[model samples]
Structure formats: C-alpha cells, structure tokens
Target: MHAIVIDDSSAMRMILKRIVTSLGFEATLAEHGRDALDKMDAADHRFDVALIDWIMPEMDGLEFIQAVRSDPRYDDVTLMMVSTESDQSKVVRALAAGAHEYLIKPFTPDAVAEKLELLGLLDPERVTAGV
Candidate 1:
C-alpha cells in the first residue's frame, strides 16, 4: 500500500514513515498539509492512506481531511489523524470532518498497526506476525 506522512516536524514524519514502511506501506513524506496536497496532486498513483498531523503551517489536518474528502479523486484514500490533540471534542471534530481513524501522538508501532487493522488497511496476519 502507498501512504503519505504529513507533519511539520521532519523527525515525526520520519518516525511515521518507518512505522508504515515496516507495516508494508511505501510512504511519501510531506512537511505540511499543503505540501501533502501538492504531492498527492502530482502523484501518478493514488495513495491508500494518509497520516496527517493536526496542526500545520498552511493547512491544518482537519482542513486537509475536508479538502481530500471534497475531491472525488481521493475518495478511496483513508485518512488518519496522527496528532497530540487528544481531547474528546477535537477527536469528534476530526471524525466529523472525514478522518477514518485517529492516533494520538507518542503512539507505539503496535498502536499504529492496531489502527491500520481497524481501518482494514492492514492484514490481520501481518499485525499478528509483528511486521
């Protein structure tokens, strides 16, 4: 599967990329939401998933989710918010805005696998095998 990792912090992006790559996803990195959108627009193949940070410089994750959902071309992409915003209201807002899943910051690789499994983006056997 192809994935996009969107975060303002390069460190965080790298971390996510590593986890997704280990889970068998080929990932593309983006500094922020706008950069992510540009990358998506320029891609020859559509991404299967997007891991987005909630707060960003040009566009926030919520706005990015909305934009992606609004575009029919991205209809099949699953959006997961990987953010530090753990408040119930923020979570609700993100889900209402079109996020398929939400992962709080400081998550373990297992947590990511669980979320992907819930989204049906990861095979059960893969997570069980600890891949």
Candidate 2:
C-alpha cells in the first residue's frame, strides 16, 4: 500500500515513514496540507492511505481531510488522523469530518500495525490487534 504522511515536523514524518515501511508500505511526505494537495495533483499515483497531523501551519488536518474527501480524485483513499488530540469531542469531530481512523501521538510501531491490521491493510493473522 502507498501512504501520504502529512506533518510539519520532519522528525515526525521520518518516524512515520519508518513505521509505515515496517508494514511494507511506501510513504510519501507532505509538509502541510497544501504540499499534500500539490503532490496528489501532480502525481499519477493515488494514495491508498493518508496519515494526517491534526495541527499544521497553513491548513489543519480537519480542513485537509475535508478538502481531500470532498475531491473526487481522493474519494477512494482512507483518511486517518494521526494526531495528539484525544478529547472525545475532537475525536468525534475528526470522524465526522471523514477520518477513517485516529492515532494519538506517542504511538508505537505495534499500535500502527494493529490499526492497519484491523482495517485489513495488514494481515490480521500475522499481528496482534489492539486499540
């Protein structure tokens, strides 16, 4: 699977890339929502999944998610909020805004693996599932 990981922090992007690689997926980087949109617009490749940070400089994750979900070109991709927001209302809002999943900050590689497994992107028989 191919993934677009959007975040303002290069360190966070690198960490996410390593975790995604562990699950056998190639990860593309986007510094913010605008960059992500540009990449998607310019590429022949469509992302299978998008891991978006909730907070960003130009466009936040919610706005970004809305933009992508509203576009026919990205309709088939799974949108996930990989963020630090853990408040119940925030989670609900993200889900309402078209996020397929939520991953709070400080997540481990195993956490990522389990979430992917639950979504059937990873082999459930090969990994232990958890929230």
Candidate 3:
C-alpha cells in the first residue's frame, strides 16, 4: 500500500516515513498540507493513507482532511491525524472532519501499526508474521 507523511518537522517526517515503510507502505513526504496536496496530485498512484500533523504553515491537518474529504478523487484515502493535539474537543473535531483515526504525538510504532491495522491498511498476515 501507499502512504503520505505530512509534517513540517523533517525529523517527524523521516520517523513517520520509517514507520510506514516498515509497515510495507511506499510513502510520499510533504512538509505541509499544501505540499501534501500537490504531491498527491503529482503522484502516479493513489495513497492508501495519510499521516498528518495539526500545526503546519501553509495548511494544517484539519484543512488537508477537509480538502481531501470534499474531493471525490481522494475518497479512498484514509485520513489519520498524528499530532500533538490531544484535546478531547480537537479529537472530536478531527473525527467530524473525516479523520478515520487520531494518533497523538509521542506514540510508538506499535501504536501506529495498531491504528493502521484498524484502518485495514495493514495486512493481518503481515502483522502475524511480524513484518
């Protein structure tokens, strides 16, 4: 499967890329929401999931999620907010905005894998095999 890592922090992007790559997803990196959208448009294949951060310069994760949800072209992509925004209201707002999952920052790879598994992007067999 394919995935996108959207974050302003280069370290976070690389960390997320590594996690998703280990999960067998070929990932596209983006510095912010607008960059993510542009990369998505330029990509040859549709991504299965997007790991987004809340605070960004051009566009935030919420805006990106809204944009993706409003467009039918990205209907198949699962939106996951991986941000430091752990407020209950924000979490609910993200869900209302079409985020399939909200994984707070400072999470383990296992947490990400669990969220991806819940999204059905991670194959059960691969998890069982410890891939």
Candidate 4:
C-alpha cells in the first residue's frame, strides 16, 4: 500500500511517514495540498491513503479533500485529516467533506494505526502481531 502524508511541518510529515511505513506502506511526503497533488500527478502511482493537515499554506487539507473527492482518479483513496483542529464542528466538516477519518494531532503512532485499521486500510493481522 502507498500513502501520501501532507503537512506544512516537515517534522509532522516525517512522523506520519514513519508511522505509515511501519504499517507496511510506501510513504510520500508533501509540504501542502498542492504539492501533494503535483507529486501524485507527476507519477503513475495510485495512493491507498492520504494523511492531511487541516491548516496549510497554498492549499489546506479541506481543499485537498474537496479536490480529491471531485477527481475520479482519487475515488478509491482514503482521506484522513491529521490535524490539531480538535473542534467537533471541524471534525464534522472534514467527514462531510469526504474524509474517511479524522485524527487530532499530538497523537501517538498507535492512535494513527488504530484509525487506519478502522478505515479498513491496515491489516488486522499486522495490528494483532503489532506490525
């Protein structure tokens, strides 16, 4: 499986990339939504999931979700918002905007893994074996 981790913070991107890689995914990092899109378009790769941040320069995660949802090519890709925006309404907005999951920041790797499992992206065997 492959994942695109989009965030303005390099640290956050690295962290997310590490988490997904540990779960058996090839990870790609992006500085923002536009960069993510460009990177996706630049290759023939089909991402299995996208881990996005709500707030960003150029294009935010919400906009990224909308763009991806509108494009048929990304229909099979799961969208997950990994942001510090913990407001109820924000979570609702993200879900309503086509995100498959929303995970607040300051979260552990296990939290991310659990969300991926809930989204049916992670294998139960891997979770069970602590992969």
Instruction: Report the Cα lDDT for candidate 3.
Output: 0.93
Give each model a TM-score. 0.98, 0.93, 0.96, 0.96
Q: Over the stretch 1-131, how does candidate 3's per-residue lDDT look in tens digits?
A: 89999999999999999988988999899999999999999999999999999999999999999999999999999999999999999999999999999999899888888888888888876666553
Ranking by TM-score: 1, 4, 3, 2
In model 4, which range of ten residues has the least summed lDDT?
122-131
Q: Of 1 and 3, which scores higher on lDDT? A: 1
The best candidate in terms of lDDT: 1
Model 4 ranges with Cα > 4 A deviation: none
Q: Candidate 2, residues 1-131: lDDT per residue as tens digits?
A: 89999999999999999888777888899999988999888878888888999999899899999999899989888888999988989999999999999999989888888877777788775465322
Q: Is candidate 2 or candidate 4 better by TM-score?
A: 4
Candidate 4: deviation at residue 118, Å?
0.9
- Cα lDDT tens digits for candidate 4, 1-131: 99999999999999898889999999999999999999988868899999999999999999999999999988999999999999999999999999999999899888888899999998987677664
| Backbone clash numbers for all candidates listed | 0, 0, 0, 0
After TM-score superposition, the amount by which residue 119's alpha carbon in candidate 3 deviates from its true location, in angstroms, is 0.6
The list of candidate 1 runs beyond 4 A from truth reads none
How close to the true structure is residue 104 of candidate 1, measured as C-alpha lDDT?
A: 97
True lDDT of residue 82, candidate 3: 96
Candidate 2 or 4, higher lDDT?
Answer: 4
